[model samples]
Target: MAARIDEEITFRKLEILLAFLEAGSLARAADALGVSAVSVHRALHSLETGTRCSLFRLEGRNLQPNDAAHALADVAREVLQTMAQGIRSTREIAGYAADRIRIGSLYSLTSGTVPALIMALRLRKPDIQTELVLGSNSELLRKLRDGELDATIMGQPEGTPDIESQLLFEDEIFFAAPAGSPYAAQSAIDLAQCSDERFVSLNEGYVTHDRFRDAFRVAGFEPNVVMTTNDIFSLMNLVGGSIGCTLLPGRIRSVLPRSVCLVPLLPAFQMRQKISVSFLRTRERDPNLLSLLAACRSHAAERPLASG
Candidate 1:
């Protein structure tokens, strides 16, 4: 018997007990708790230890709560209600309960796609609050996996089995050159021709840099990467000042200055990177997750492609 019932009374364990009581079956209770049946069963044992009483009895096919459980139902309800209030109060204190939505995104997509989606989500749920966390693709994916994000907009789906991803749009990579530069007037340039030109690349950890390296391998040549920057904006500025040529999305043409020309790939080594929203597959049935997914899909359908 566990004597530290109060000490062991976690919100999750309490919720599990209450869910089992209300649902009358472990399967239904697990569904309500957003966990597997095994987890729910484990929680029941923990709950029993906390309460120091046999909560369930073995039946022919189904497990049924005993008298001790029925007696403890009132206490369980109070615990659950208190837990619910705590969540509500926390949300109120954060000011997020007032109709706000939080999102995450990769730095590359945050500039254009996120803003458009925020505005669009607002149209559907007016007065909705919005928060966007921007980071590298790996960082954003990590946050999404840890339950720290509602969903994330990033390039390429991660390899995590617990995550779910849906492609929203496609973007093509292109060559970026300063305006009025000799290369600006060209329709395209062969990778071999670019061998002698100084290149500005993303930092080694960046997915963009990895993609560029893969393309180089395909082109059968290594680039003269004289400069490296972590942010695309910095790389763009360097390219604008004629520091060096860099690879950029052709979609950026609308936002960039007319002086900078987006040259097509000569052999057209355009890589179609998928912009997607990722979330945990375990949370797929959650009401909040469902609402956010529908909102994201609806928003994606209404917004234009990353072109500009």
Candidate 2:
């Protein structure tokens, strides 16, 4: 008689368990999942606890899956396959048939790049519909990996090999301050010169937020962060209010209020964010995805070079 798997075990846990079985190691499974090894270990431990069974045996620091683990993995594979097929069939029957492309993008791009791309795509395929989701870079990448989004426009994704990306354009980062601030008069300033200045930044999980921190690291000082918010516009508003200075991409210059001044960073301290259209490589052949990718490429080619 076979042991019953825990009903509380989630599909994600099962997927992790199956990954462990196939990869034969936690680190390899984590690599495949685009997560940390600690995450894999936690999932596996949770699965074992929920099942109340020893699915793996530790042998000289390596976890070896037992027979029970193999059986569970087999079941997990079948379940996932069935779910995928069911979803595809339902969508087909509903006349959706992948006609709608769900795209994710960074909040900042929604104002210009996203709208332009959507307009161009609509012109090319009037019958198609697009759903645009805005989020931080890490959030969008996670959605893309989980199959929640067909593709995403974001800064170049790092450490995520499962995603294939095409560079759209290069955007330069600029130092932003209140219009009346002394820094506004300079043509270019080194980041170190702003070491004592209060900074307003995006919250963690944003690519720009990471880049902001990196700038501070390069400048050899910790930033005096006075505010952290999720919205780029809100951060800009704070800068305009003279709350603190910030680093922003040139693409946002059109929306900047006159109260805010954007100054160029010295060449040595300058940073550029490479915006890209990214999607799971597995969906490269889907007709709708292909169309969207083509539109993105076209739009990127037509965009003007980033100004300082």
Candidate 3:
């Protein structure tokens, strides 16, 4: 005989069985559990198979549960409640029941703004533990909205309602070119002048990519495209290799290769990316979140280099 407790008798199946028992019909159970009627039937069938016993009897067009089914449903309900309580107790012990801050940030800020803000936050709250999530601007904003992250450091997200943001700093955009390129020797270059030059850029969904495209719009022409990459480092390497020129934030100059030059764009064509610390409005009163926001404000007031 198969074991009574086997992998087939999963927690999900148990939940389904309990729902089926309470609702008295597969269709009703499916509605209660937000699943298809067929899925409810399948889980009940699997449960009966795993237990190696008859759980239901087909009475005309309907399924009527036997004594065994009722007994198992009682046990399953108790088991689910116990498991839920165990999870809550574990979270309490792990300090997650309190205000544990989870901060999200741009991947590019990991080596710079993120570390500085973290260090400053720790200084203020030595006992506080933090979780840092890194992603693109859009991903971070979504996570923040879903409560997965308490706050995020990124370029200010536009058209997102119900988020509160504090401006951290403005980073100027520059035209990056090969060191030996003729344009590198000039103190500044016009974006229109590079209209015909092949360019390397970040793919869509990145804030920088949108900014790069907008710069071309200001210059009144489309950019000659060659390659698109995910990270700024790769884009910089492409420029260093003389493959193409690209636009990048001025702060990135601290890490650029000597073979790459970051030339300023003329004032008329200059673009600036505004970095901000953002959080859901609902989390505004959270002490840990407030502390983190204070740290960000302090860091920005110091006017530190974007390279950290």
Candidate 4:
């Protein structure tokens, strides 16, 4: 009868060996593995004992793998890759794969590009169902980061590390006032003229709310906010009544009633918005996510989006 082998090989041992080979020293290998040097020493000892062969020789500060250890690298890598694939497959079966995508966007996109994109998606893949969430930039990004939203079309979020983005459009921000107002008659008005003037602005956390605030600051002034509201319609109502002037996007020109006029900012300060599609890069390849991405790209290409 053949002698039964009692040695047990493990993935951890393989990882340690690989780390050592690449780092060329126990201290460096430990750092790469996020462990201490003493832990690395123990792992190497375990691996050496299991194989019943000398794998490494310490010379100066370097740990050099001998021939027997060097020869096992290819096999170790193949095993690790196989294990990773298995884990990925398990995650897919658990509904972590692209089975569904939850989309979020700014309210403005809902009226035009977003609706067209949704219809186009349904036409392309009738069986795919999507959940659309509407909110301002800050809320959408919060949901996106919290994993409550799969993707969102909002102004570019600053300092988001794990999020990925693709730019779709750039639009100028304009000053909007009721039609026939002296401010409306001018092609452009200095931002400072309104420094002490009453204004209507979006509720806190809205993307444009911040943009308008920043513009005021840049112009060396602060706005006299007469009112703040979440609904754009309400803001429009206030502007129409001449209650206050508010910042608006140029795209709304054709849509807004004749009672509203969009004028350029003095010295022409623009928010230069870039409507983008954003999602976690790790989630990009999910099938449902892939579908959503395709829809956004197609819609962007077909629409008359603002350029540059």
Candidate 4 lDDT, 138-235, residue by residue in tens: 88988887888878888877788888887767777888888988887797878877776789999887778888887888778778898998867677
Q: Which ranges of candidate 1 are over 4 A from the true structure?
A: 1-77, 86-101, 124-128, 303-308
Tens digit of per-residue lDDT, candidate 1, span 151-223: 7777766567888886677777888889878887788767666788888988865567777887777777888
What TM-score does candidate 4 reach?
Answer: 0.67
Residue ranges of candidate 2 with Cα displaced over 4 Å: 1-97, 304-308
TM-score of 1: 0.68
**Highest TM-score: which candidate?**
2
Q: 1 or 4, which is superior by lDDT? A: 4
In candidate 2, list every pair of residues with a backbone clash: none
| Residue-by-residue lDDT tens digits, candidate 3, 1-308 | 97357778999999998888889899999999999999999999998889989999999989899999999988988999999999877754433434366888876677678889989988878887788887778778888877687789989988867998988888888889999999889999988877679898988867788889989999999898899987788888999999899998876766789999988899888888888999877667766777888998899889943421
Evaluate all candidate structures by whole-model CA lDDT and list the values in order. 0.74, 0.86, 0.84, 0.78
Candidate 3: global Cα-lDDT? Answer: 0.84
Per-residue accuracy of model 2 over 58-115 as CA lDDT, tens digit each: 8999988889888888888999999989999876443234667789999899888888
Tell me the TM-score of each prediction against the true structure: 0.68, 0.69, 0.66, 0.67
lDDT of model number 2: 0.86
Query: Which numbered prediction scores highest in lDDT against the true structure?
Result: 2
Ranking by lDDT: 2, 3, 4, 1
